[model samples]
Target chain A: AQSVTQLDSQVPVFEEAPVELRCNYSSSVSVYLFWYVQYPNQGLQLLLKYLSGSTLVKGINGFEAEFNKSQTSFHLRKPSVHISDTAEYFCAVSPQGINSGYSTLTFGKGTMLLVSP
Target chain B: DAGITQSPRHKVTETGTPVTLRCHQTENHRYMYWYRQDPGHGLRLIHYSYGVKDTDKGEVSDGYSVSRSKTEDFLLTLESATSSQTSVYFCAISGRGIEQYFGPGTRLTVT
Candidate 1:
């Protein structure tokens, strides 16, 4: 079984400052990683995903995440943040090579990014 | 934007009352799922459907039940609601890839 852990409960950053949100997962088999962002009273939006090939995955809203297989970590980073970026971020993982019909994603508790001016 | 919609976006009910939430999708995806979100717990899967009339329980499925009658509609039923069941419920549809598209969510309150 696979599980995810978002190390930080909340991260605060001023506008134009860089920010990083840490995530770790545990799985016996290979897995696919994803990042999703949720705004206030809204549903989750796909930020990015790492299926294979590259460790660094680019996402929407100028966000990116690096997957470190050795450490079982996928950390999201952004060089500059905006006040609109204040929202909750979730990290999820799915067992690799699984069919979409039976695949399920295990999600982390989430990290709230607070971007202020 | 996978053309998913959740009905009764906000609801309030008394304890022990039965409630049902509806999810409709236009994408005609094969997989659908129901999840509840609370503070400190990002999202916990309650149930999922791989096809019409085919459903399975998830990590937190004790107090919830789900049904998918048609390709586009998935229904979640809470028989005898409790205060602990109050939460924001989200419905999702899986794409050809491993990614899932989410609905706007329904905020349920049990009084």
Candidate 2:
């Protein structure tokens, strides 16, 4: 079974400063990686995904993650953040390939990024 | 924005009562899923449907039951509402790939 671990439960950053939310996963087989963001009282939206291509993946709102196979980590980072970037971020892994018929993603406990002015 | 909607956007029920949450999608996607979100835990799958009349359990399915009688509707039922079950419920739809779309959640409060 695939599982995810988000190192920090909450990360507070000043506006215009850089931020990084750490995520690590454990899966026996090859897997797909994804980052999702959720606003207060809103559903989760896909930020970015890593299927098989470039290890450095860029996403909406400038969220980018690097897939380190050896480290089993996909950490989300942003050079600068705004007050509007305050939200909870999640990292997930889909261990089974697409041919499995349906997508089942194992999600990590979200890391709440608190952006302050 | 996957053309998915969940009924009873907010519901309050008493213990020992039965409650069913409805998830309807217009995309006619072959896969529909029900997940519950609580503080700290991002989201845990309760159940998922592959097709009409076909369903499977997920990581957290002990207290829930599901049914998919048609292609566009998936229902999740709680036989007896419990305090621990109070959380936000989200419905998601997917095709045959790693991309999945989510719907606005439904908040359920059990008293």
Candidate 3:
């Protein structure tokens, strides 16, 4: 079984400040990692995904995450954030392989990003 | 936006009553999923359909049933609505990939 853990339940930061949302996963096999964001009164939208290749994955809204296999972490980062970026971010993982058929995503509890002026 | 829409955007039903939520997509994606979002639980998959009449249970499939008679529509039903089932339900679509596009969501409250 695979699981995701978000270390922070909430992160508060001022506008234009750098921020990092920590995420760690437990999986024996190679997995695909993703970040999804949900604004107030809306559904989630994919922020970024790490399928293969580069360890540094850039996503929409100037957000990026690094996949560290040794640490089992895929933390989301932004050099600067805006008030509009205030949302709930989720980290999820799905096992990758031919044997893992019809695999579903396992998500962490979520981290609430609060951007203040 | 992947042209996904969930009907009955907001619904309130009493406990013990049957409730059904509809998800419709226009992108013709091969995969459709149903997920429920709670305050601290993030999102948990309830069911998914790979193709018409080909559905699978997800992590949290208890007390829930799903049907997909067409590629464009997937329906989720609660046999007997309960307070624990009150949450925001989202519909997502993917086309043979890991990335999924989500709909606006349906807010269902079982009172």
Candidate 4:
């Protein structure tokens, strides 16, 4: 079984300031990491994903994440945040399943990013 | 906005009543999923389907059932609504490369 843990429940940041959201996961086998954003009253949008290769993956809206295999961490980072970035961020993991039909996603509790101008 | 739509965006039902939610995806994806979101719990998968008539239960699937009759349609049914089942439900379609596109969500309140 795979599980994801989001350390912070909420994070507040001023516009143009840097922000980091921490995420960790537990899995015995290789897994795929993903970051999704949910705006108010909207569905989730994929921000980025780390499937293989590069440890540092860049995503849309100037967001990036570093995948640390040894530490079992995938932390999202943004050098400068904007008011539009205020939303709920979720970290998820998809562990390799027995077959292609058995894959599942395990999500964290989510971290609400409140960017104030 | 991956051409996914969930019908009856908001619904209110009493306990013991049966309710069904519909998810329609135009992407023609091979995989579809049903998930429920509650306060502080994030999103939990209720069920998923890999192909038509092929379904499997997830971590939280005791009170719910899902059916995929067509490639673009997945239906979620609650056998008997309960207070604990009051939450926002989202339908997702899996795209290429392990990415999922979610619906707008349906808010169901079981009083």
Candidate 5:
């Protein structure tokens, strides 16, 4: 079974400050990583994903994450955050599918990013 | 918003009553999933369907049941509502990959 762990429950940052949300996963088989962001009372939006080929994957809203295979970590990062960036972020992992049949995602508890002005 | 919609955006029902949440999608994606979100728990999958009439359980499947008779509709039923079941439910669709398009969500409360 694949499981994801997000170490931080909440991260408070000021506007124009850099931030990083940590995520780690445990999976014996090959897996894919993803970061999703959710605004207040809204559904999750895809931030970025690491399928293959690139260790550093950039996503919407100027966010990016690096997949470190040895460390089993895929941490989300931003050079600077805005007040609008305040939201809950989730990290998830799923096994690499064989021919279109893939397993469901295992998500972490999520990290709340609180950006202040 | 790739044509995914959830019915009864905000519902308040009494305990022991039956409640059904509907998810409708126009994208006709092959995969549909139901997940519940709560404070400190993030989002937990309850059920998913790879195709019509083919459903499977997820991490949090107890007290919840799902049915998918058509490609565009997936229904989640709570047999007997409980206070523990109060949470926001989200529906998602995907096309055989990690990227999933999510619905706006339905907030359900049991009092």
Candidate 6:
């Protein structure tokens, strides 16, 4: 019964500009959050994850996301983006503890980030 | 890719024909999963295996079957291919957490 919602279907940004991709989840219990990126004709790669401890988690490629427990949001942000950063990003969530024994991840629809010069 | 590979990277079959996709891994991970990606749907899990011969159905498992006979290989089969099944399929593996490494993906089409 867990679900993820990415508000933006597409985000267009110029090079060197800051960008944020919004993600929200609905889960009754504690959950693990993750962000993944997929370039053209390639598989998804992990950008970052929020397991515990830190509220602001930094990830690969100069990306960071903050896990706001009260708002049920984990939005990804970057100070600046490059043309190579153009890719489809996904937000995923999995419940904590024995309930997630299989470790199944529930993913949002995805947000396509189009970075241009 | 985490040493994961999917065979028949691009396949096209008829509606009534049977199709099977193979996923091979070299990392010897304990968990393997099969997911399908469609435009606007992101990725939906079809099946997963915790160990050899120990498989479980995922959220979108209808009309699909999976088999994991060995730790290194997982196979997904469609009894009858349909247009709705025309999408990219990805294989993922995880050792201990929810962090999964994905394969290059196989593009399947039913004409």
lDDT of 4 by residue, A66-101 (tens): 999999999999999999999999999998644553
User: Against the true structure, whose TM-score is highest?
Assistant: 1
Give the poorly placed runs of model 1, Cα more than 4 Å off: none
Per-residue lDDT tens digits of candidate 3, residues B1-111?
779999999999999999999999998888899999988888899999988999999989999999999999999999999999999999888876767889999999999
lDDT, candidate 1, B5-111, per-residue tens: 99999999999999999999999899999999999988999999999999999999998999998999999999999999999999999968789889999999999
Residue B4, candidate 6: how far off, in angstroms?
Answer: 0.5
Chain A agreement with the truth for model 3, given as TM-score: 0.96
Q: What is the DockQ of each candidate?
A: 0.72, 0.72, 0.56, 0.60, 0.63, 0.62
Model 6 per-residue lDDT tens digits across residues A1-117? 799999999999999999999999999899999999999999999999999998999999999999999999999999999999999999999888852335789999999999999
Please estimate how well model 1 matches the true structure, expressed as its whole-model Cα lDDT.
0.95
* Residue lDDT tens for model 4, B4-107: 99999999999999999999999888899999999899999999998999999998999999888899999999989999999999999885657777899999
Summarize candidate 5's per-residue lDDT along B1-111 as a digit string, tens digits.
589999999999999999999999998688899999989888889999999999999989999999999999999999999999999999998875657788999999999
Model 2, docking class: medium
lDDT computed for candidate 4: 0.93
Report per-prediction Cα RMSD to one decimal.
0.8, 1.1, 1.4, 1.3, 1.2, 1.2
Better of 1 and 5 by TM-score: 1
The residue-level lDDT of candidate 3 at B96 comes to: 60
DockQ-better candidate, 2 vs 5: 2
Report the C-alpha displacement of residue B94, candidate 2, in angstroms: 0.6
Q: Show pairs that collide, candidate 6.
A: none
User: lDDT, candidate 2, residue B76?
Assistant: 97
Better of 2 and 3 by DockQ: 2
Error of 3 at B75 (Å): 0.2
Q: Predict model 3's lDDT versus the native.
A: 0.93
